[model samples]
Target: MASTEAIAAAFRIDPQILEKWLEGKQPVLAKYASAHQQIFAQFEYIGGEWHPKLDRQSSVAMLDEPSQSQNAVESDRVQHPNSSEVDLEPQSTAMFQAVGIVTGAVHLDWETHKHSAIINGSTYPLFYISQKRKAFEALKAEVAATGNSRQRLIVYPRVIHFPNKQRAHEIAFQLVGFDKGQQTKQEVSRELLDFEFKLAGLWQFIPVCRIPCISIFRNFSSERLDYIKQAEPAKKVKFLKASHLPLLWKDAPCKPFRFNPKAEGDQGHPTFVTLKVKFLPERNVFSFVEQLTPVQETAPPFLKASKKDKASLRRQ
Candidate 1:
């Protein structure tokens, strides 16, 4: 990601033209900017300056990792000719607010993804890695208690790149402004399913966070197969046996499950639990936020018990 000073030094272009080039929307030297995209990433224009699409971690590292001392970094800042002092610190992380729904939470160890929420119809992926887990827990509890899969959320979002996937920049949210009073609505349909299961309070390893956290997962294939085979016999469906839908608990005894990259198998038992899920495009995974009691299969109401069955029941 090219900085404003770097772009200026290399191109020697006017600030206004540079702003337009960063927009990448209207026609203004599109050929030149496109050709140079390899040299510069997609940038956003802010306060009449260029901001590169860099992840928060990388940006913070850039500020901290340099050998220069704080005084030296401060001295290197671009000084205004009229003013004696100029602070070189980059601007604060940009933020904006939106009313979104808490879709799902995703944590994948191999991908360096954790505490991330897929919100607003799965369009935004916001993550928080601070030591505080309360915000994330609050989100999970709200969804579970309300049973309304889509809870209206007031979110303050910022931009961040995937820590493992550097070139892929996306939106993130500051863990704040979770109002419990917000109304929620359930979006259950023929394709979606959900149900709950109690955790044994076991400890498990989460790869992304690099910590042993309490988490649990249940395979819903039996239920899924039953629904598919009975509801649509002609429709062909393939199951990815390795893809287990992990459950999110309201007041989970431990943190959510994390993927163990080195484990030979995903340790979990097969259960008849149904899950209400949403797909996270950023991580290419499904997150189950709400769970419901498994619906048992029953014979047709018109069917009557045979005399032999009644006799067997009497003997029992």
Candidate 2:
């Protein structure tokens, strides 16, 4: 008789196989009884269940020393005992198989959504929708034209927060481009699209924020005074020599960077500022605008008045 936890662990390893093993009558019961008599001795048959007691020291001893021969006996008791005991190989195989099944199921659902990309083998929840309406429309049309029966598209939105300035700068630099004057906004936008596509393949979406300058100081510089002096307006203000900056939306205008005075350390040490970012599904830019537009109210027929009244209304 095994403890409930052990039984549960066995079930988790392979439930169906265990079930099959438990079924089917065989004369092997006598061999099991003989080999594991100590195991049986520890348990008192209470009602329909076997309640284990401490009296079975020999059974406990067996547990402490697992023999390959004993495993054969255990295998007889449970289906796929060999699989359950074999190290990482079986577990990894099972996990990969499970992922494939899940991905297949997701592909069956929203395959119609064009421009939708699955990330992380359809595991992590993150996706990006194009900010353009035409892009979305094209995707929908393409999917419709293909007449594909299977769901192949799975997209998820992700929210990312930058805990420090350096990381945010790096991400922003990547999306917006680092070329001094060669990169135009359009070029930057295209680069963003490429970045989005690459990320979409691995994850649904990645929202990256600019790391706070203060955080960078806390992470790198040893002298708090040096950090403060460099940060002050009186001193030569320099962008911290870091790899990355925060990411902004493709169409959104770049805003001037500002630091929070309150965010400064209480002991005159510097701290990092945080930024928030969010990624969504890809669609056409026009469609996004249309979706965001508010409907206007039409005036009643009575509101349509004579020229004089209209003039008066205008004047009012």
Which prediction has the highest TM-score against the true structure? 1
Query: How many backbone overlaps does candidate 1 show?
Result: 12
Candidate 1, residues 28-55, lDDT tens digits: the string is 4665565356335544333333443334
Candidate 1 CA-lDDT value: 0.33
Query: Cα deviation in Å at residue 216, candidate 2?
Result: 15
Residue-level lDDT tens digits of model 2 in 1-316: 2333343243243333323334543333443454235433444332222344433333122322235543211101111111211112111111100000101112212353312234333322212221222333443455466664223222222222333323311110111111112243443233332223211000011122332111111121223223333332211111111112222334322222343434544322111122222222122100011111112121111101123322342354
Best candidate (score: lDDT) = 1
Candidate 2 accuracy as TM-score: 0.18
Q: How many backbone clashes does candidate 2 have?
A: 44
The alpha-carbon deviation from the true structure for residue 42 of candidate 1, after best TM-score superposition, in angstroms, is 34
TM-score of each: 0.23, 0.18
Candidate 2, which segments miss by more than 4 Å at Cα?
1-116, 123-134, 146-157, 160-186, 189-316
Worst 10 residues of 1 by lDDT: 234-243
